[model samples]
Target: MNIQNPNRCFLGVSASVTGRSWADRLDARGAQTALAIAQRHGVPDLLARIVAGRGVALDEVPQYLDPSIRALMPDPDSLTDMGAAVDRLASAVLKGESVAVFGDYDVDGATSTALLVSLLRTAGLDPLFHIPDRIFEGYGPNVGAIEQLAARGVTLLVTVDCGTTSVETLAAARRLGLDVVVIDHHLPGDTLPEVTALVNANRQDDLSQLGHLCAAGVVFMTLVGLSRRLRDLGHWTADRPAPDLLQSLDLVALGTVADVVPLRGLNRAYVSKGLIALRRRQRLGLTALMDVARLDGPPRPCHLGFLLGPRINAGGRIGDAALGTRLLLTDDPMEAKRIAAELDRLNTERQEVERAVLEAAEAEALAATGLEDAGASIVVSGEGWHPGIVGLVAARLKERFNRPAFAIAFNGETGTGSARSIPGVDIGKAVHGAVEAGLLVKGGGHAMAAGLTVERRRLGDLRAYLEGQLAASVETARADRALAIDGALTAGGATVALVEQVAKAGPFGSGNPEP
Candidate 1:
């Protein structure tokens, strides 16, 4: 395949000046030495040069390439409130208290819910799960859902991938005499909800070394903490096998990659180990998914992100997101195969809808600018646009324009929107600002992506607000778009041996991208 301008907008690096500075640094740092090591390891010289350009140290290569849980994982105790969360959950399990897991509908939420449910069941606890509908209930915990769960005899509620910004919902859960434990990765607001324990890597004052962990990774870490606590309390013994935390790494990897979280620190370990476990076909659901997707070999990050991720996301985006969680948690091969096939069909349908909506969104966006041509940032909204595919449309627009983009689905009186941003522009902050300005009913996300709900009347104002906030940053970001090659090399340098050696540095995604 032809590599299209690999240096253009290379991971949002500025090519003209900053890119040159990076190149100069690489040259001074003995780029040739790095290239030689790449060659010795049988990796492409171009990739090696890129790695050298990124200033990754020689000693760090092992950790980057051959990430091992034993070597790279941080202690669970390092997370704040982790001990308390584990203790609370252990008590619930021992007391046979019904626990409810409130999770988001996305891949991270689904996978995290699956991991926690599996872990609880392994410890002999029957855990109930609740995933809010993205279209109906929105992102996080809602008061209605909490009430329903509490009424169902749920004494403890554990929220994964969401609930950090859900102040009112959590407060309601507390009022219902339910203990709440929140394990999330989203950035928090000023006053956190009153909960039994809040465990999030993005907590303002959190000092956890694994800040890059996704929701599933956080859930895994919490399980580790719970296991340790149980061991200390003499509740677990060698005769009773400890919860196999490693078994959940596959879910962690799937979530981390699908959610597009940065793959650094503990995340690297999860993906590396998870990929190995996935390749071994330990999970019938994942194996069936691979078969449905026509993947003949072990699933890679690309396959997960492009093929499998979309299929899993389709459930949450269009159909029932619980389908994804069920697919991951099931043990029966035939059932897994059936679910995989359904997900595959849903993904195909999603793609078709997305294409039609994208065209309409693009037309609306061009018309809004009142020019035959528009600049980098594109924000557009239209009636009857499917909320499920708005995020994908935003992503496509961002790629085409090389700028921040937002696509909104207008349904007469109400609207839902998703935003994708160029590097250096914080889309989450923009969404937060809109919320603060009362332009949006609610919005939250990371720097690169965000979601929002707004009154149809506020569409114009929302667009203006985003444009004002993103204008300068978009220009700066676009002006700097250039591909900065790590180094130049002949095609002869691209070998299977080199790819394998470089593969060791992989499980690579956002943040710790593969060179």
Candidate 2:
């Protein structure tokens, strides 16, 4: 190993960013079944190898590559309370009762709300919807908003991408004589909220393994459940047929990619189907958004996540919280265009806000390396840091340090922030642990990301606890870290057809990384 550039991979291909070559450490023949698969399937050798390297079995290759909703969709009733949730929703739709759908302010939340809004309108029910202001209400439903919706003659309330953890808020709604259906994917807490139905794929007792589903996916399944239940009940006559779930896959795909859930299992099918739907551009809102984003081609996961998701989320970050939901739910092209332009401007503003936090957090991150106990995770805090962009800062720090990271912003009295984690380290559980330890005011999240609040005075304890908690896992993951190269190629050999072939292995994100 007398290599001059230890950082650069020299497998006759691209090297690691630090100029390191993990090629020698890579097991190129790891996908030994790929050759046989290629021979049997009559496909390119590289394609088979790429699929095998991604852990797709030979028997699973066809479905893995060409995911179909029919082949992969799970029974929604298999999830707890799914039937009850659908029944409740159907009753509201049929009776023409005033209904409100509440969602968080993120892209997942916005899309989830939009999906429900679209479905309800199609069913001839004009639904009332609410996307809480991130600055005022933070995440999940608050007490005041519930009361307002109730006062607006809302007989039923449906929560999308949120409300699983709002035990108290839903309880208050219960007292107000409001029927509530909770459709969320976040890991649920002990003693679920007392709603009309609590339908979550990630419910502690769920065996569906649909925990990988983003909120939009979960919401889409609920639509399927509701439609089937309605059809079974003869609610849908000849004129009013079932609302087509396929038409809404675009929303599901956008939220799925933007939320950064692993594109595996049903998620893979959803994205595959949704991408096709997106290409059709039947949705007026999506077409308007693509125009404003200047995307002159079929929308891809990258366009959804990086280009469009940011603009949708920009409203939640610095502008009106409901802008994204409105943009997605509207059928009017004029309204869509107006909102899209406004959101694009807001996204630029968000970049500026994110940069300020990134610069300050970068300084703190660099300064930490010199400390005696730098710990495994990056933790940075500063007064006057905008809570909106803390997650972006955490992601930046994590990328820079190749570890888990958290950025807390102090607003004199309280600190609210976000956390971003690497593959092996579960920052969601870490935040939950901190909250359980009474180190945080309240917090809950999934494997990779989370949000929390704390008393400004106890910030030091929260930091220390997270450091101690994640130190072992982070160190262990780093110690065992080894990049596996799928294959190698020369610059001249990388043709357009080859690029297309390689792309067949993707739709990759958090868990199912690009090969």
Which candidate ranks first by TM-score, i.e. highest? 2
lDDT of 2 at 271: 82
lDDT (10s digit) by residue, model 2, range 1-515: 11223343435544467644464222335346888678877677777867776677778888888788888888998888888988888889889999999998999999999999888888889899999988788999898999999999999999999998899989999898899999998877666898889888788877777888989999999999888888888878879877778989999999999999988878888887888999998888788888888999877788999988999999998999999999998879899889999999999999999998899898887886733346788889999998888988998888777788889888888988899988778888888888778988888889889999989888878878988889898877665444555667789878999888777766776566777
Instruction: Identify the leading candidate in terms of lDDT.
Output: 2
lDDT for model 2: 0.84
Which pairs clash (backbone N, Cα, C closer than 3 Å) in model 2? 7-19, 7-20, 8-19, 8-20, 8-21, 9-20, 9-21
Model 1: residues with Cα > 4 Å off, grouped in runs: 1-48, 370-376
Each model's lDDT comes to 0.80, 0.84
What's the CA error at residue 131 for candidate 2, in Å?
Answer: 0.5
lDDT at 143, model 2 = 89
lDDT of 1 by residue, 1-515 (tens): 01233333334444455333122234434567677658666555655665555455666665655678888767887888888899899898779899999888888988999999998887778889988777888788899988998889999999999888889888888889999999998777667888988998788878875666778989988888888877787777677667778877888889999888777767778888888778888888888888889999768888878878888899989988788999988989889999999999999999999999998877777676644256546888888888989999999988866788889888889889899987778888888888889999988887888988999888778777877888888777765544434544459977787677556556667865555
In model 1, the Cα lDDT at residue 500 comes to: 70
Per-candidate clash tally = 12, 7
| Model 2 worst lDDT window (10 residues) | 1-10
